[model samples]
Structures are given as structure tokens and as C-alpha cells.
Target chain A: MTRASRLYRSSLLVAFAALALTAGCGKKQAAPPPPPPPPPPPPAKPTVTLQAAPTTIEKGGSVTLSWSSTNATALVIQPAIGNVAPEGSTKVSPDATTTYTITATGPGGSIDATASVNVTQPPPPPPPPPQPTLEELFARDVHDAYFDFNKADIREDAKAALSKDADFIKAHAGIKVVIEGHCDERGSTEYNMALGDRRAAAVKKYLSSLGVPADSLTTVSYGKEKPSCTESTEDCWQKNRRGHPVLAK
Target chain B: MIRQPRTPRIALKLHWFFAALLLAASPALAQDWFRTGTGLGVERPRVAVADLVPRAPEATAHGKLFTEVVRGDLDFSGILELVSPSFHPLQSPGMPLQLNYKAWSDAPASAQMVAFGNLQESSSEAAIEAWLYDVRNPSSPPVVAKVYRGAPTDAQIRKFAHQFADEIIGKLSGGLPGVASTQIAFISNRTGSKELWVMDYDGANQHALTALRTISLMPRWSPDTSRIAFACYIQAFGILSPQICMFSLELGRPVTFPRFHGSNSAPAWSPDGSQLMFSSSMSGYPEIYSIDANGSHFKRLTFSAGDSASTSPAWNPKTGQSAAFISDRGGFPQLYLMNSDGTNIRKMDLPDMGYVIDPAWSPNGQLLAFSWRRPNGNFDIYVMDVTSHQIAEITRDAGRNERPSWAPDGRHIVFESTRGGSRQIWVMLADGSHAHALTQSGANESPNWSPR
Candidate 1:
């Protein structure tokens, strides 16, 4: 139907339509309520800050560990310092350089930060002065004191030699000497060992009496094990029975 | 010379003379020889060791080894002399049943006793039957008739022979068994370093007891023979220091004891095995100290002030009541005697040899053997009569002989000598006669005879 002609023909129907619309309008109407404005963006994630006082220190020194965090219900520090409050500080004395980390967590998410300390080592000491070797001391400065067969008594000649030895050893403040008592190829091994010890001790005693430090002298026995001369003659044996002074390091 | 024969009168006279000779040579006649005179020099019994006869052809090698070992043991016993096999009769004494008393009594082999053995051998084991015969009285039973069974290896054969020899000595000498089965411990550097070693009394089967690979000296056996106390150089704070260490032969390892601050050396066990005596430098100078065997009661035996040194303590094996030690209190090293309680110290009455050291007491407590050096630097082993103070030279003109240790029987001594071009162990009569090398090779020293 033509829109205008249909409208004229439906005038009467239109009036009825109007009355029905008015009745319909009188009934409760159905429509979507305007959507609530989009929810506000979620709150930003919580943040944390960890710091240590005295960032640099010498060995055996201590440091203060401080931390701050937001929105975290619980927090902890690893490696022995277990649990701690969200915002607190503690002291630590780490033998070595170390780093500390802090973490914060919430419904928005989590965040972490760290701080470190530096350490410095002390400088090494200077090298000591060169020391005279045992060979040099024995060969150049000290003389062996000869003794009679099986005798530990200091002879006049031995006294002269030992005096020189004492003087040389005393001039060097830090130097110590060991008196070795030796015997010729004679006697029981066990007895000779003791005899040698006595000879050395006798020399040590003589040296000590001469004002040498007693602690700076020691004694050992070679018995007949180490003979300076291998020949089985009187002269060789005489040479072997002596108190030999050796430098001790 | 022409012979005068065919007379019954002359033959009767000869028979009487022969009978008298047999009586004079009897063991019973010589039994009191050692106790009759001054007991210094007595004739050793003449013993003939017959070749060990083999029961089987396969046993010949082992039988020879056994015979050699037995002969060596008897020779070294010092209480007997082994009649050379060269003196044996032409006919072999195949077994005890076949032994001819007249043959053993012949000239050059008139043995007072004869050791006869028979060996039955298999692939790995042997049964040895040893019998000691009284050659003078063949009608009487054997002195020792034993059957020993063991593996026929060289070591086992030697062991069986030693056991049989010990039995013979015990029966004949009426003293402690022969040291044939005993072992001597000494120091050896054959492994490139000085260490403790043990061997048969005859120097067979020598093997290291301590492989410490460091210097170990003076291995002194405990009275009970269960442990060896020695001075071992151990690393302490990176320095080689001598310390007294104990090794248990039963445990086959080192044992722990109290550690002193300084040197601890020259360990000797008390006769009763209740305590240990050692020299310690803990008091600034080497001095004698003693501790209970379990290391409880630590007591200083010497308290010398200053640089005086007292060391090398040897306890009397009988009572542990007296000790012989070396001290520098005298102008030189000299032997000193002290009570076990560390009191009543006295200078030993020793010869004025320039230096006197190493005093070993006899098991019978009669003599002290030590080395004495003369003004000419000649050292000799001199045995001093502890009571009479009579000193006798045991060794003379032999390469340096030292460190004399008395055998358990007190009739023989073990010592060190350089007479054979090298330091070696030697065994001799207590009077220093019949010196024979116990160790043939290597430079063996510091021989300590085991008291078994």
C-alpha cells in the first residue's frame, strides 16, 4: 500500500494504535541500563628498596642492612637471616663482600631491588733481610773444637777455637748454632751416641759460660756413624773426635 | 812309626783309656763346667747335626734346607758348637733307626749329641721327624724326638728347623729356649730411607716392619714382645721432630700416646710392662721421663737445671728397680745408675775411657756391657762386672763394635760391627769370642734382640 493512502485508510486504525501504544506505554518498559563506567585501572605494583650502610669496608668489618617494601604481607632475607618485617634494618658482619636483595609482593604483582658492599684487603708486609746460609757460617766463620779420644773436656786449643766461634756467632744477633759431637770408629753404637751428645753438650756449656745465649745453642750426636776421616789410623780418628759447630736456621 | 800289636795286655790298657776319654767328654761331665769356675769362659757343648735324611726323593731339596737351618741355629746358640758335616761318617744316617752311635763318636765328629731328622714331603707340605741322640749312650732314649708338619717352602722349612733347635737347646742347656726362633729388630735404609725391620735370629726373612718412609731409630721391644717403641721423625708444624712412637705388632699399625711439646725419644719399657721410660726435651733440656703404659702417670725422672742432658734410659729386665742411663752431668757422656723411683742417682763405676756410653744390663743382673773409647779414639766393647767392677774387653781390633744386647739366656750377645767393610749385625759369646755375622748384607745397625 502507498504509504500516504495506507496512512489515510489506517487513520482510524492509527487512533486505535495510539490508544494501544498509550496502554503499552502505561506498562513497565524493558531496557539495558547504561554500562557502568569501565573499572579504574588496577593499583600499581608495590615497590621495594634494600640498602647497606658502609658500602666498602676492610676485612672483619660489619655492615647495616636496611629494607623498605609496600603491599607485602611477609618478607625474608636469604642465607641465614630468615624472616623480617616489610620495613626494617639489621646489622651484618660478612667476612667477604656480599649483596642483599629485597622483594615485595601484592595483588597488583611483585617487585625486587638489591644493594651491595665492597671490601678491600690490607697490603702485604715487606720481605725480610737476606740470611746467611749454614754453609757460609760453618765454612767462613765457625771452627770445630778438637777433643781427645773419648773426651768431652775442652782442651786449651779447643778453647781458642771455640772462643772464635762464640765471637762469630754472637756478632750475628739472630744466628744460632748447633754443636755436633762426633766420635771415631770405636765403641758400642748406643754408647757412642750418648758420648757424642755429651761432647756437644760440653761444648755448648762452655759456650754458654762464655756469655753466649744458652738458648742459642743446641747439641747432637753423630756417634761413630759419621766419621770425618775414613782411615783406621790414629791421626784420622783424632780429627774425627771433635765438636763441630754448624749454623742453625 | 812301627806298630807293636798282638799283645792282650796292651789292648786292655787301650780299652781303659778310651773309656776314660768317653767319660770326660760326657755332657754330664761338662754340665757343671759353667758353674764350676768364674763362669767367664766355659767350653761350649759339641753337637753334631746329621744331614736331614729324606723319606722320599721329592723331599731332598727341603731336607737340605732344613738341615742347613738347624745347623745354623745350633751354631748361633752360643751354648753349643756344630760339628761340621765334613766330619760325619761315610754311611748316611737315613733314619733314627739306622743312626750309628759309633759313627758319630768317631774322630773329628765326636759329638756329645747328634741331631737327626727325617723328612717326608709331598707337593706342598712336609712332615719332619727330629730326634736328638746322646751319642755317648745310644742305648738311652733320644733327648728330643718331635714330628712337625708344615708347608715345605723355604720359610716353613726354616721355621720347623728353628722350632726343633729350640727344643734341643732347652733340653740341653736347662735355661731359656734358644733365640733361634726369636727375631731381631733393627734399622735399615735399604728402602732408600731409614725404617724399622725385623728378621729371623739368623738374619733370614728380613722385612720392614715400619714403612713410615721416614727416619726411625732404636726399636726397643716391650718386655711382653707385643709392641715396639721407637723414635720416629714426624712432621709437626712442618718441622721434622723426633717423637716416641709405638707400633703394635698384633694390631699391625701405629698406636697413639700422649704427645709432649718437644722431642720425645729413646723409649724403653719397664721390666714389668707397667711403664715406659723415655727422654723428653719438654723441660728445655733432654731429660728422663716416665709414663704409665696407658699414658696416665706422667713423671719426670730427672730434674737437671740448665743445659745438662739426661737420656738413654735402660731398665733392668728383671725387677725394673734400677736403670742405666747416659748423662752429661759429667764432663762427658757417662753411664749413670738410678732407682726406678728416680732417686739415689750415682755415677756408674766405669773405666776412665775418654767417653763411655750405651750400657746394656745382663739378664742375670751381673754385668753391664758398654762401649769405651780410648784416648787414641779406639772404641771397644768392655763388659764390667757390676759387683767386682772388673772390666774385660769383649772386642778388640774389630771394626767399631757397639750396641751390645744380651740374649735372653745371658750367654750370648747381639751387637753391631763394621769389621766386614759394612756395619752389620753380629752374634758372639758373651765373652766376645766366636764373632759371626748375623746379617750378611746391608748396613744394619741398632739391633735389639727380642726377649722371647
Candidate 2:
């Protein structure tokens, strides 16, 4: 072979070898870059579950919220009703029937479940008719004049009863009443009479508040006289400690 | 005169025996045999008046009618003396007319009194008849006083007799009436309740008038016996409200007057009964207020600071302008007097008495009856002369005696006490004599005597 032809053949062989080596290096570098990007993403799975808890609590009524996926650490619940409970075991009071969503998460991934309940109200009964009697009306007035234990001034119950009495007075314009105050037999006659007077005045004031004419009601204290039942019992005492409306001649 | 009759010896002997028996029964023969002569030259036989009258086993504590009447008659005549039957015994039984003069003359008394009566428990008034005699002058007719007091209890008979003695004393002293036939109205808490009760001035014939379930306090009577006014609390608006209510005893019903907004108590009626003055808190604190009989117009009489609560008002009937009341203006309660229109207010200086309340004017306006509380926390009824302001305590050891009221005749005062562990009514003489309990039940207070 000629010396120039031999040199051409060697140069071609060298160029072919350099091209094969560059191709092998490019293939190894591409495989390592993809594996590093995937490893960092696994830590972000916990955050995904935390973000999902608020959505689960939408239209909240009685509900308990929880989160777990943010970290492999223990789950935390805030503003606990009683004390810390197992995950997904917390109960809330005054539960209303409504749709509820529960969220669960782990280091691997997150998931949510939804439940629903129906709400309804029962119907009410009808009101009773009014029955009018002198004694009954007086009793209603007396019941409204005083408060229960440790209470000064009239209570709501008394006011309600007085309202009815006032309505009756307004309806019957010609009927004038004398409010006779009475007390239980536990105290002195003079003291009881004074107490009775206070009771009668209170009734008159309530009746006036309910639009009854003040002139139509005269207040007097009978003290302990005229007990409806002459006995010494709690029930009798309660009955005696009252005011009575009598028709004025 | 001489009589002679001849008879056989046997018949003559029988006649002599009969004549001797007749002689033994003769008054002159019996008296001559019983008479005895003293060493001082045949001293006259003394007599005891008690021996001339029938008596119980023992003389009553205050003396019996016969003993008292004889003593009174002898004391009035100033010419006779009496000796106790225990020392000089003389037995004369049955009625006064049946008395043996000879037997009574032998007693150590010169005069005697005889009394007879039937004591009944069912009635308060008693009927008694008494006579006075002089043993030295057997021919002189006996003096008698017939007393018909309604029924008197056994406990009261002694008092009744004392009253008769008083009458005899008055007759001897030339003119004072006996302490009898007087009635007292007082507050009683008997019947398990407080009520106004009336009894004989000597503490008998007690009957309650007020029918109150609560405490009936401070009872005052109108000038006429027809009505009464008292302070009581009536239930009003579930609270006890004090009031001054009038009760017409004849009508048998109670009518309450218009009470001021606050406490209306301690009522005192005007002499004419046309108006009533009372203590009220209508102006935020207790003050004196007067209201007409119809309760139409209420006039506030006083205005003072410091919760000047006025209580127990009294009006002078004669002057019709002066009034007295209890005022707490000086940090403690004291008695104060003022004009009827609330003018000329003055404090009464009552030394040693811490509190004074419930003033009642005597009918004659000469004195005032009131309750004075001592520093030791005890209360007693007292009477003070208006002119001299001389105070006299009427009750002692009577726990919480209060609300003294003068009787219409001004001879007695009624008040309330807690002496028996419960409030009761009591009566005593104007001079603090013969005090007795009038009420037996409930808690009674504030007694006011009836004007009549």
C-alpha cells in the first residue's frame, strides 16, 4: 500500500472511536438528573393533606378537624373540647344534621370522605281557650306580683300573668277591683299586713303597666286575715301569700 | 209582877226544871253568864266585825268584805275599834240578821260588818250585800251597801271587796267614788292571734274584738265605744304593708283607710273622731300626717331630715293645738312635742331613758302615758305630768312593756308586755296599782284604751 493511503485510513479510525465515547458519557448524565428531582417531591405529600382539612370542614356545624400528612410526627388538634382523643375520634356537642367531610393523610398521599344528614322540626300544638272567673282573675294578678326565691321585683312569669289580667280589666271597663294583699301565717299580723300591702301595691303597679286604669284598682292589705285555707302547710302558705281582687260595691 | 200557884211536890219539881231550861235559853241569862270582868274594873267586852259574818277558810289576801267594811265603817265613825277574830274569837254564823248580838259583844271589837254574796265564774260582775253595825249599841240599825257588780271571778272577789271598802272610806271622808265599774280595752294576742280585748277595769270579762290574721298592734279607741282604730300590716304586692285601719265594733267589720305610700301606723284620733293623725312614710320617711274621716285629704304635718320617722302621735283634746310624738331625728328615738300644724317642735329631756315611744294624752290633758325604754334594753310604761314633766314608771320587771294608753276616765292605763314569753296585754291603775294580765294568747302589742 502507498504511504498516503495508509495515513488516511488511521485518521478515519480515530474519529470513529472519539464519537462512540462522547455518546456513552451523554447517556449516563441524563439518568442521574431525573432520579434527584423525584426524591425531593416525596416530602411535600404531608402538606397536601393539611391543605385538604379546611375543605372537609366546609359549612361547619358540630365538627372536629384534624391533619396528619404534613409530617411523620404526631397529629395535633387545637382548642380541644375535653382532652386529646384518638385521630378521627373527637366528638362535638349540639350536633346539627348537616353534610360533613373527613380528611385522612399519610407520608404517601392524602384522601377525603363526605357524609350527609337531614334536618327537620316537629309541629307545635294549638292554644287553649280563655276561662274567666273572679277568683281565677285575682289569682292571676297575685301570681304576677311577686318573684321567686332570692328575686326582688316581678319576674317574667308574673308579668305574663299580669298581662292577662290587664287585658281582662281593659275588656271589662265597669268592673272596679280592690286588690287585697295577704301573707302567710308565719309572721306577726302587723308585719304580715304590711307585706300583704306591698304585694297588693305590686299587683296594682303591674296591672297599670299592662294598661289597666290605675283608678280602677285600689290597693289594701288584709295582713294574715281571710286565709283561703286555715292550715299550716307549705302549700297553704304559698296560697295564703297572695293578693286577691275583689269587686268594689 | 208576882205569881203564885200551889202544886204537889212532884208537879212543882217538874215545873222548876222547865223554868230553869227556859232561863238557860234567855238572852239576858246567856249574856250574864258569858260576861267577864277585867282587872281594870269590869272592862266592856270587845267585839270583832269579822266574827259577825260568814267567811271562807281563810281571809283573802287583800281582806274580805266583812273585815274591810267593818274596818272602814269604824274608821269613818272614829268611835269604834275592831280586833282580829284570831285573838278574840266570836262565832256568829248564817246571814247578818241571824247574828247573835251577845256573842258579837263578847268579841274584842266595838263594831262589826256583815257581808254575803255568791261568787260565780261564768259572769264577770258580782252581786254583794254588806252591812255595818256597832256592837256597843245593839239597838242601832245596821248600815248597808248593796253592790251589784256584774260577775267577778274568785281572784277578783278580794279586789271587789277592797272597792267596797274604798267606797266606805269615801263616804266617811266625805266624797270619793269607789274604784269599781270601770272597763279597760287592751290589745291581746289570744286565740292564736292579736286582737283588741275588753275587760272589767279590775281584769275580768275579757273578750277579743279584732279578727286579724297578722299582728294587730297599737290599738286605739275612738271617743265613742262604737269603733276602734289599730295598726296592722296587710299583704300588698307580695310584701307586708303597714296600715291604720278602723273597725266599727257595732258593724262587725273593718274598714281600712287610705294609707300613704309608705308605713301608715300609730294612729291617734282627734277628740271629735272627725280626723285621725298617724305616722306615715309617704314623703320618703315617716312623718306625722292627718287624714279626714273619709280618707279624702291627707295633710302632711311635719318635714325633717335624717329619716325623721315619727311614731305614736298624741293629740291634746283640750288645747286642740298641742301634739306629742316619737321622733328619731336625734340618732335615737325621743319624745317631741309640737303644735298641731307641725310648728314649735321641741324635744322632751327624759334623762336615763334611752328611747321613748307611743305617747297617749290623758283625757284631761294633765298628763301623758308613754313607753320609755331604759338603757338596759328594757321597756316600761311611764306617766309624765305635762306641767312639771315629772315622770313616774308604772311597770317593773314587765318585759318590753310598751304602747301605754290612758283610759277614758283617766284612772287606768293599758299597755302591752312580753313578760309571759309572749306579748300580752296588761292594765294598771293610774298610780300604778293593781296591775293584772288581760291577755293570754298570741303576740299582743300596742294597746290603746278606748276614749269612752
Candidate 3:
């Protein structure tokens, strides 16, 4: 915009210089002192350029601020960087967004150029998701299938539990587990040992049919040796007579 | 053994019995004894065993032990009733010459047969003279007369008594060999370790055979009673592995058997003692496997589809053609019959839904005794007739009677029970009569009768 205005003014000045020469020959009306002849082009306007290599940066990051000027006798930048050479670059690290303006001054006038460096705090790294432990996963995803007294047959509730168990097992292809068959204290130690196995095996067969890898399962019978509940009530026994799945090392 | 009276010339009878002297070992009359043992006899005769006579003051202790042991043996013999000592005549015969038969057969004594014995113990050796006679026909002949001589140790005295008692039982039972001298191999933790132990059939003189300080279970004596095959928790190749372990009675040490992979346990010796059958998880599931007695030839005896746990294989003592074991291939564990070579597997389905485990074949192979946890009840010992598949629960309402192993006679069973407030070893007649504890302390379990 300044260059256009300067060019138009220079053209008018040329026409005036011609009129002054004509007036000098005629001596008509007290002629104003003719202005000095306009140079071929306006004094080369001072041009200032300021640039930041990386317009945006992290809070702890830095950017290169480069600047140059033409036909300037002096140059200076705002925002902490003061006087600088006509053409130079400097690395600036700012904790906040900042715009640097470099002013170039010369015979014609002063020109200002600006470059912005935007600094952001980078969305606090997504709080590391609370990853669930394998044990917790087992507790949540794998369920125990309960049985009736002296029974290894899968009941309706047991099917539902095992259905979820199969999904969990299948979802985690790398997981290996021991399906423990537990028996109530009502059975004999040795007999329950086998009975527990029956329960574990029943669950395993069901899971296998549901697409669980057979090799990933190991069955063990705790029998009446390891009871979840020790009370003589039926509720405790029911808790014991269950097929439980656990993560294996 | 004396079949005829030989003391008439030595001393004539005038209320005094004639003398008999015979020191010979008699062959077992198995047919006669097997009849009584089978419980088919019409009547059990009342027999009286007179208190042993100590010929010398130094022999009195041994005499008492011998007398009491014989009386106890007769009490448990099943074929006869023992007359209480209180009903015994005050003056027992020291020798045949001192016997008054009428006294033995009279009111207070009232014994159809009389057994008399005398012991003479020296510092170095002990000797015994024992005789059995039909008090009703005392003048005819002596039924049994024998002599025993051995070192004067207490062990020797007990041995002599056992020999005398076994002789009386064998002769009186018609021909069934007595188990008095037979030893029972069991697992005992009296020494603070689950070790293999051996005791007399009547529960005396128990001593540890293995001090491995590890768990040993389900001990079964070899057919020859020389080696005990058992399940042992031991380290093999630096890994804690459950493996079949063997303890040699003759060698008096734990003999090395081949070590297989995974949890190998519950060992059963084949009837011939040539091979041993055990449960092994080496194939990723518990299955029956057979290895030579010397640990050379290894063979898999069971193949359950898709990781079924099949274990506890018992070969028939009489027919060696088949074996009885427990398998869960049918959803729950049930008795299964398979050929000795692992062929012809058949499930022994019962009339009820339950868990059947610890399948043990009777000595005659006609029956399989196991623990079945019925749907309506807890674990109880059950005996199934192999031919008829008729099942009878021998143990009921007893705190979890399990692991029933038939005695060598096939008329009695030994099992583990929790009825006594703790796990203990118990024995009963095959019909579940006269149940008594053989072990009372330290959590005994998994009692397998020796195959005498």
C-alpha cells in the first residue's frame, strides 16, 4: 500500500516539475520555488521481515526467529529481543504465545513486520488409563459356575457364568488359566477330588465348545480340601461346589 | 502237624490228656479256609485258647504275649467265636499230658476245640510248642501241634505267636490261610512326615519304611510283599513332581524307579508284579499308565478323549484280563472297566447320578469296591458286583467313608474314614460289619490293603 501511494505521488511530482520549468521561462504570476526534480524512483522504502521457523511450539519448546531488512539504517525487535543486525536469526523459547515485531528505520520512514510464536501446554498427557491387573480382570471377566450337591452337570446359572467366561477367555487369547473344581465338605476327600475334577471338566468342555482354546486350560480338583466357605449351611456348601477359573502363571 | 495222637505211650489219660509232639509246617488247606472266609458257613464254632504256659520263670512275659495274641487273632478270625478268658478253666494244660478234655468241654469253658501252648525262652533263643485239639473227641487225635524256635527278641516272640495263631486259623477254617503273619503297608505321619509304614495285620509293630520327609500315599504291597509301590511327592530333575515311588522291603531302602513327567501318582502293581499301573499327567491330563516293575517298559493304559482325567487302575487279581479304574469321561467320575492292555473300555454306569472314585478290585475279581458320593448323600464305600453290576453301599452315614480296598481274603475291606473326628484307617468285614479303626492318630488316609 505504501509503495502504490509513493509511486502515485512521484508521478504527480514529475508533472509539477514540468510545470515549474514552463513557469521559469514565462515568469508568470510569482511562481513558487520549483521543487527539486523527483528521482527516477521513490527512495527505496525500508522493508522489514521477521519470521519464526516454527509458528507453534510446546510450552518447553523453542523456535528460530529470523529477520531481515532492506534499505534500513537500524533495526530492532520487540518482546525482550532488542536491537539486532539487518539480517540475523536467534532461537527464542517462550512460555506463552508472543508476537515479535521488527522495526526497520531509514531515510524514507520506519516499517514494522511481525511473526507470531504460539506456545501451548500440550493437553496434559491423558492421565495414564488405570490399567486393570490380570487378577482383577479375572475377577471381573471370569466367573465361577456353581453346582448342586454331588452334581457336575452345568446348571442354567452356571451356563450364564460360563458364557461370560468363554467370552473373556476368547477375548484374551494369550491368557492361560486353571479351572479349579472345588467340592463341598460333604463329600469324601478322595471322591470329592474326582468330583471336583468333574465340575472343572464340565466347565472346560463348555468353554471349549464356546471357542476357548483347549490347550490354554488346565483342570485341578481341590475337592473338599479347599473350601471357600466353612460353615455347615447349604449356602456355604454351594459356594464350595463351584468351578472357578483363575489366571495361570 | 500231628494228624494222630502220639503221646499215649508217653502218658496215659485218666482225666489227664495224652501227649503229642510234632514240629512240622503244614501246607495250607485253602479250600477249607476259603469256605469259612467266604461267609457261607452254617455255624461258627466256639474255640478256647488257653493261656500260654511259661515253662521257665524267664519265659512268663513271652507266654502272656503269645496267649493274648492268639486270643485276639481268633476274635477277629470271622470263622469262629473265641471263648472269653473269664470262662476259661483256672488250670490250663501246660502240655497234652496235663490236659483234662472234659473240663474244656464242660459248662464254664464249653469250648468245642481247645488250643494250648507253652513257651520256653532262653537268653539266646525262644521256643514254643502249640497244640489244638477237639475237646469233644480228645481221645481221637490232635488237630494241630507245632513247634516254633527263633531268636529271643520281642519281635521273634511276636512272630512265633503269629505263626501259632495262623496255624490254628488255617486248620480251623478248613484251609483258608490266616492273615496273622501278613503285614499291612500304609501311610503314617506319626514321625512328622508322610512316610510309608508297615504294621502287623492286627495293628502292631508299626515302623516307617520311607523317611523321605515328603508326602507318600496309597501304599500297595507287591504280590510277593517285597516292594511297596506308592504315590510320592518328590523332586525329579529339580522340579516338584508327583511320581510313583517304590520302597523295597527286602532291600530296606527306597529303590529308584523311572521318573516320568508331570504329576504321576496313585500307583497300583499288576497282579503278577511284572508291571505297575499308575496315574500320570505327563500327557497333559491324568491318565492311567503302566511301567514295568523294574521301571523299563512304559505303556499308556488309558486314553480318554480330550483331556479326561482317568486314574486309579486296579487289575483283577484272579483274571488279569481286565482292570477297574475311575474315569470322568461320562461327565462325572464313574467306575470303568478296561482290558489290561488298555482295550475294551466300558463304563460301569450306576442307577444314580453321583461321583464314583477309587475303584478297587476284590481279590476274586468278582467285585469292585469304591467310594461313591451319591446325589442325595456324601461319600460312602460301595461294592459293585462286576458280573451283575449290582451295587451295594457298604458304608453309610459314617463321616465320609472312602477308598475301600478289599483285604486279601476278599471278605474284608480297609478304608479311610473321618467318623472318628479325624481321618483314620478302618477295617470291616466285606458286609460292613465289625467296623474298627486300625489307625487313630495323625490324619491317616488312603488305606490300601496289602495283597498278601
Query: What fraction of the correct interface contacts does each predicted structure contain?
Result: 0.17, 0.04, 0.07
| Candidate structures ordered by lDDT, highest first | 3, 1, 2
lDDT of 3 by residue, A72-184 (tens): 98999988989999999999998899999999998778999999999998778878989998789889888899999867889999999999999988888888877878899
- Who wins the TM-score comparison? 3
Error of 3 at B83 (Å): 1.7
lDDT of 3 by residue, B36-120 (tens): 4222234466789998899899999889888888887777766677899999889999799988899889988788889997888
lDDT of 2 by residue, B271-304 (tens): 7878888876545445788888778788988887
Write the number of the candidate with greater lDDT, choosing between 2 and 3.
3
Runs with alpha carbons beyond 4 Å of true place in candidate 3: A1-249, B1-33, B36-42, B191-193, B236-239
All candidates: TM-score:
0.65, 0.49, 0.67
Cα miss at B57, model 2 (Å)? 18
Q: After superposition, how far is residue A218 of candidate 3 from its true place, in Å?
A: 7.1
DockQ of each: 0.10, 0.05, 0.08
Predicted candidate 2 versus true structure: per-residue lDDT over A14-63, tens digit per residue? 76676566668744553322212112223333331222222222233344
RMSD of candidate 2 to the truth, in angstroms, is 22.8
For candidate 1, what TM-score does chain B get against the true chain B? 0.89
